[model samples]
Target: MRRSRDVPLLVERARAGDPRAVARLITLVESGDDLLPQVAAALAPYAGQAQVVGLTGSPGVGKSTTTNELVRALRSRGHRVGVLAIDPSSPFTGGAILGDRVRMQDHATDPGVYIRSMSSRGHLGGLSAATPQAVRVLEGAGCDVVLVETVGVGQAEVEVASLADTTLVLLAPGMGDAIQAVKAGILEIADVFVVNKADRDGADATVRDIQGNIALSERGPGEWRPQVVRTVAARGEGIDDLAAALDKHRGWLVEHDELRRRREARAAAEVEAIALGALRARIGSLRDGTELPALAARVAGGSLDPYAAAAELLAQLGA
Candidate 1:
């Protein structure tokens, strides 16, 4: 645990581009340290400063490769970038299973970029529960862009839309992703669709599938339509087009004033999660006390109904 007094200094160092300080702050966020309140307080002022882009797709869709090329493209335009790659957790160790981040080794020595692979730790939404706080840490450290790459858990990955200002759904030929997108409700969440591995066979068909789906969806006047860009990520092909699409979407977000609304919703969800966690902790504490057990006994013995017993428990905790 870090001393609460050190939080301000750490935040200051991070803002000055001290990678070690930034790393420490993210570690604190991931671990849910006792001083997290102080860290969040210190970082609150920098909220919503970075362009948070989330990249998600199936496991074999070249998400990492696309992210790497996108990072390079963004850096070419001189943007300070941060990447949070959420990898599946090792069941035994509860650590990031793909911690090496082999595809992103090209930027390891680039001080202009910060990359961190976080364990999803059994989190169901393809993201770690701590991701939002970690993103705040990166924003406080002066990153102009933060790319959140999800664990690619398919159907449950729509949660990324809540955290990102722009969500890119990557697809590859023969992956059936175009069809799966409809069934998984991904069509509603995607801001841009990237048909990666565009040099492969069936690439054109995949693009057409997505385009056809987009045409079928109804939209209100002036609503932003999703764009599709094809890319051969391995060869660094069409990356500029993808970047252009992202910038265009960002401009639209600003023009339509959707960015502020999205950030406000993100903040509200974070607060609600924290409040629910505190409530759960209070309930857990009552297990060691008499309130919960007494309530359980009454409910089990038919002396009190379950809903009334729950109400009594909440009342006892002053909830």
Candidate 2:
């Protein structure tokens, strides 16, 4: 664990564009040891300037390719963009795959662009616990745009929806019936949709399906109706329109107090989640047989009801 005093130096180095120092700070935060709270508290002052955009969908939708193209487009418009590509955790190191080095091919030499691939770390939302902190770090370093790319496995996975100012849900043609049946959350959370891999067959049909879904869900014309833009990301087609749609969503967020309220709610949720997680970790350590998975198994066996077990464990720990 780092000494708490190092946070200021780390922040200064990070702000000065020292990637090593920034990387080290992130390491200290995501390592799941001591100093997590201290690091989050220290970085709190430097957070929230960047607009976080979450790119999420099922695999084979070419989300990373689409994201790479979008980065190039956003940069062409003179924006400084940061990308957090959250991949599967490396079991050996309990860290992320860190495959972003190969995936984000275009921005290597551009000093204004920064990319980091994180491990989901068994975090169900497709975002690691460190993700929000990483976003804050990029915002502190003056990144005007931040893109979070998820693993894109789960149905209706919308982890990024609550975190992002706008969430881009990518879908490709021919995903078929099972994938298509995913559900309302994914469709409902999209601020703007992207029909990527548009050159493939069924592209037009997929567009219409999403359009019809959006129409069914929208309450009225006054509600922000997210537009589905087609793109062959590999060819960079429709990149301009996608960027424009993101900008339009940002403009709407700027005008809406409701969006600001959502941000507040998100912040509150983060605080509560962290507090509960830390408290559970501390209290569980003090009690025998109170580990999360064990308790879950016991509950599943009907040996103990969940509420009673939790209360009993907490009481046993004097928590």
Candidate 3:
């Protein structure tokens, strides 16, 4: 229920690094508030200012732990960081089932860091529907880097590839994730393969398995190859190697001009989603009007073919 007039002030405060303003703006985005369009417009100028990195993997792979360490690593280099942890929602109450803040207490008192956990609310693709807009909010809040941590759902989480400038797919030893990576099509989306928990038994075997798969894949000349980094995130071991891998990938993205291409594609997808949602809303409104019912009646009576009736309905809706 945010007012449209307040959007400008919110955006101004967010640009000045006000955490509460950033939180309020993200809440509006998540709730689909009536003034969301105004909020988006106010924040549009700051789009693409932050480096968005997505971390996703199956449950128990230590995504949150890795993210916590990664934030510390990034902050060490003086980067203002924002984290959006998408947690699975409770089936009954529709609230976040896991609280990420409990695990990332080190940065709770840091003014340069902002962390917010969003419930997936049964949304598919391991992310909340408002994730892209929420990223925009973080960018507008002057964060140099934004981390998007998925809900850790298997297979369906590949959608993160479309949103992230660089996508990190985490796997651990003894989980058979190296084999699952192929079956789940994770090999195609991973820019960096972080074999976390490197201290575990069979860790080398898992790394070898992923390297073997990477060797078998075909790539065009100058295409970026995924880098594999091992880490024991629980003890903050090998985090520097992980950070180096991320920086290397970022350099490649810039050198190849892939960053602009990826951002353009992300913007195109966001625009299309908004357009489709508006169309669906308009069609829903027509459900209570005469056009849809008349069309349905004609089709049910077999007096008009469904294709033609649909065309007429679209025409009536000025679509």
Best by TM-score: 1
**TM-score list, all predictions:** 0.94, 0.86, 0.94
Per-residue C-alpha lDDT of model 3 across residues 15-66, encoded as one tens digit per residue = 9988899999999999888888899899899999998999987667888899
Report lDDT (CA) for all predictions: 0.87, 0.78, 0.86
lDDT at 70 for candidate 2? 92
Least well predicted 10-residue stretch by lDDT in candidate 3: 92-101
* Best-to-worst ranking by TM-score: 1, 3, 2
**Per-residue lDDT tens digits of candidate 2, residues 1-319?**
2577777778788888877766776677667647667767767876777888988877678887898999999888888888988775546422323344576767887888888877787777557877888888787676899998875556325678878888998888998552466665776788888998899999989998888887777466456788899999999999999999998988888786656777788899888888888887877665554375677789999998999878866766677
Off by over 4 Å in 3: 90-100, 181-184
What would the TM-score be for candidate 2 when compared with the true structure? 0.86
Candidates ranked by lDDT: 1, 3, 2
lDDT, residue 135, candidate 1: 96
- Model 1 pairs in collision: none
Which should have the higher lDDT, number 1 or number 2?
Answer: 1
